[model samples]
Target chain A: MSTVAVMNGNYAAATAARLARPEVIAAYPITPQTPVVEYLTLFAAEGSLSSRMTEVESEHSAMSILSGASLAGARCYTATSSQGLALMYEPYFRASTLRLPIVMNIVNREMISPQSVWGGPQDSLTLRDAGWIQIYVEDNQEILDQTIQAFRIAEDPRVLLPINVCYDGFYLSHMTERVEVPEQAEIDAFLPPYEAKHQILDPRKPMAIDPLTSGYLVMEYRKKHMDSMAAALGVVEETDKAYAALTGRSWGGALDLYRMEDAEYAVVTLGSVTGACREMVDEKRAAGVRIGLVKVRCLRPFPKAAVAAALARVKGFGVIDRNVSFGWNTGIVYQEVRSALYESGRTLPSVPFVGGLGGEDITLGLVSKAFDEIVAAVDAGRTPQSAVWLWAPRKGVKA
Target chain B: MSALDLLAEREDMISPGISACVGCNVELTLRTVMKVLGPNSILAIPPGCMGGVGVVGWNKQSGAKVPVFFPLLDNTASMLAGIRLALDAKGRDAHVVAFAGDGATVDAGFQALSGVAERGDRIIYICYDNEGYMNTGYQRSSSTSKGSWTSTTPVSKEGQGGKRQHGKDFPMIMAMHDVPYVATASPAYIPDLVRKVEEAMKVKEGLAYIHVYNPCLTGWGIRAEESISVARLAVKTRFFPLYEARNRKFKITVPVPNPLPLEDYTSRIKKFSHLGPERIAELKDLAEERYRFLEAVSAGGGGRA
Candidate 1:
């Protein structure tokens, strides 16, 4: 039996990790992601969490500790955000290359320059090529569900890679929502205990790991890693179906479509902004406009085929990215969507939308405005060369 | 049994031969230490002379009989701590150890090492301090002695400049962490070094740290045969004093009552040959001052200084 509880994203993440029963957990505190570590330690203190928890001094040591634990054939977990993610980049990249099945919750926070820390997917999106399978969630419920499924996907022999379950900070991390906490027995039945087969650190069976290797062998390892990532696409779908069978809830694998069928225009989104976009799609449909919503769940191992197929019938589409690509003059996901379309050999008129940076709210008004631009581009038979800014001038504030 | 006899009877954990300097005492220190740690150990060899010499090995082959790997240069201690936790989780008893160099210990890796000590993680950390980054063409590290000429701290053609700062007293720093055990060892004193390793292994709770002072032959420009003797002079002159601290209780392992003159040690090494009378006297006074502080700590019941 599962219990339905009202909690924030951090609590959901912590609850999911507890149910997964990781053998070792090491995490350092950071804004937005701080409460996840606190909750885990509290669980351990109360004797509910059986994992050997270590309070690491830095995110670098946190990831390093998990890497070592995973190398020793133990399931591991951790959480971080923004600057903390940047600090752990060394071990974070190595964790995936070493193919350790460590699950980390990235409570997505904005990277600092002028110093703002409300919410954004820029933290995880900037590291999309770091080899970890990244899954962005829409709400607290998905935060709990996907983090639980993350262990199964990462520990799968066909896809033995570290994974990141990323969700927008403050928007979901601090905001309360209904979450279904799965039974321990149910989660145990779903995610079997991780058993290392490829590499391990054990005195009984001595072997060297990450030795000085020739260029030829290094290339071979990289090819194998790529193959595993491609293989993970299938594993993700399979795990989603299996979880749905057990829990009667399924977050669409890779990409979640809302009223996408028989629709002419699509508003593509990721993370917490998907909720507002879904409402906007419904409102547009009620007003007799044929529009839909596409929420990108899995960013890495990018579901390129599914994305291209989903937009095949639509006259045009617009991607609403909360993070920018800097050089591309558009959001990161906009480029990704365009690249996937390019592979499909379909050149459709599309609009690029960039907004909601640094935890700024991506309100329904902004999402509806983005849909209008997509429709305008499609009807006019011309794609805009530059991104449309979803900006709203506040009272007494300059543009 | 004697340290030599104990070593002769025990199986050597390190592989027969790969590559090290002609007379590298760091290599000897590693071999002797691994023998004491034995097969029931998991070793972390970070980037250093040992790692560059293929201690972690080429391709898939291992450099030691026990499970060994190259940890990142700045994460050896934390990685070992993780290994210890996982091993304990499996109800398995094995010594989780790190054989790191001073560049990986006192410099970049210090924060992670300090974290492990404070957390009371049951792991043995052994740092082979050969003064500087010897494997990287003798670059100056925080562990490099003052007045020593490293590639990065080069002297002028007329023998003018060298390192400006004193080397960090790293073993004493670890002792202050109040970990289960902290000790300084030397390659010249095999018995004392062996006993320290034995003591580190006996520490079942918290961290056990052993810092070994080894004089580099190739990097420091010393004769291959004079490697062990030069290392001996370091201890004899009270420059790198041999001591141990159990839970902050200090004890000089090999007390040098009538210590040799600082020139007796510095005159033998080319790195320090450029030092004039004033510089050599400065080195002598610094060593004496450090020794006096150690003596006070030892006499004052070894609490916190």
Candidate 2:
């Protein structure tokens, strides 16, 4: 591994793409994600990279460029966040359906309803069905490390799906941190050149791509897509193990269960908030409370089984959601964990805590309060509801 | 001109079993474009006749020897820019051509096209102007010329519901970029079309625009065999002038003759058959007015940057 002095999340991502040597880099400047493309252009200008950078008018066009590039048998990369991802809605779905192994890094931010630009997982979660393999990173190091692993996981012949490596806006993207960038030869041996089982434009042979078909054909196509996605679970596992061997860092499967084995109470969350929750767990344990934390690294192909195993023995659970499902009463993660437990033929009274949305600071105190709620329920020998909103402020607290 | 003989011996680049409908002018347009671009080009096709005709299945391609990248309908220009970039990264310089129908070019794909051209990505953009959304079954498009009857522009009992807007002036728009090359040709004028394509291919930078006048036999209700003849008549009647804009200068390739009356152009196609005598006269006057403006431009200095 090589130590680059220091870099922001966006530049690190761009450097990762450069090291991976993607053939096509299509990007349009959007806030938070803009510096990624700008740095890529800098790399291109200095002749440090050989990839082509397309100046697209919008995020929609940026994704469309990757779709074409992917078909042409190029390892393609793009960057966007918030409304940019929303603008790319149509082709984003197409890229995943076609199962092109394009890699993209999304600096996650909240979508506009009341109209604000701040950080959250809402944008990437909203694209949950886009058939993209979504991985959330906790810090700049994870951002750089996961960006490299993402290409391996997505381009795995068994998977053949697009990947979105999500990091939080401003918090992770703009912040500087020390990251270990692996050697070019190390990446070369680990990831390998992208050789597709099928390419849209191979002159040696002829084929048809994207034919319009009847409803039944589309259904079968969807089934095949789902089957491929299901197949990706194994590919992701194998690639993570291989990555760990090469770097001495094992990012346990889709979800990482931290200290949940013997704990009576657990809290689950994604992204950098995992660090704060872990800290809260340490602090609560010093006070002699039996509490643990679960960090969901992969939000898509969600580790339902992993979560079930982690929470099977726990008495009470709380989910820290940095984003809320507008129409739902509780947090989105709470709904997923609840459904997973229900599907697994087990029950855990999980409280949903919504906080840190739109760049709001998710303090350890807030997380400690959630632990207090969960521990009180378990100690009182009372089962909480299937889910309850934990940190929603009361009317008097509003300032 | 001898290149036509060389092409004659080669099998038609677009294979016979492709999905283009029987007697569709797009078939000829595709054949002509493939011949001009040769076997080494990469085509960026979006939704419309060209896209439908080209892509058949995932990883399945048509008869063209070169690669064709089909992006979403509205993003042909941007995708072509990407294709050019991809090729450049490999140290391989090849033509990146965006071939889309009038609907894809003049409507949804407009903003992307504008961006790519302004960025001057090395791509050749061709709008096969068939004047309507023929693939989706004869719906109206921005390129549907005034007085044309389409499924959406049904002929009324009072005969007033033809296309309300004039066809968009794409060549003018391309010229506005002061691009290196912008030319208009028809399948009927094969030699001229081939010459323009050859010239555009030699240009190393910036965008090259070619607008091909493709006649719609099904939508326009003309004989399938008369597609070429109809396009030729369009040029002769000054309804579709043959011209080239290079470095922002417009040169009328086909000088206006004692230009044939609008009737000579309209009477042949059933689309314009709905026109009354008075409407025909109005159409004739509009065509002449457009011709005079173009002629004056040609006479003074043929637009040049």
Give per-residue CA lDDT, model 1, range B1-305, as digits (tens): 79989899999898889599898899899999998888998999999999988888888787888888888999999998898888878888899999999999999999999999999999999999998898889999999988999999999989899999999999999999999899999999999999999999999899999999999998788999998999999999999888889986888877777899989999989999899999999988989988888887783443223
Give lDDT tens digits, candidate 2, residues B1-305.
46577468655556666667676666777777777677776766677776666543333334455665566778888777776776666566667787788888888888888887888888898888889898888899988878788999888877778988777777777778878999998887887787888888987999999999888888888987787788888888888888887875567877766678778889999999988888778767777777676666653553322
User: What TM-score would chain B of candidate 1 score versus the native chain B?
Assistant: 0.97
| Candidate 2: segments with Cα more than 4 A from true spot | A213-221, A377-399, B19-22, B53-66, B277-286, B296-305
Model 2 clash pairs? A207-B60, A207-B61, A208-B57, A208-B60, A208-B61, A209-B57, B249-B303, B249-B304, B250-B303
Best by TM-score: 1
Q: For model 2 chain A, give the 10-residue run with minimal summed lDDT.
A: A383-392
For candidate 2, what TM-score does chain B get against the true chain B? 0.92
Write down the TM-score for model 1. Answer: 0.98
Categorize the docking of model 1.
high
Report residue A8 deviation for candidate 1 (angstroms): 0.6
> What lDDT does each candidate get?
0.92, 0.79
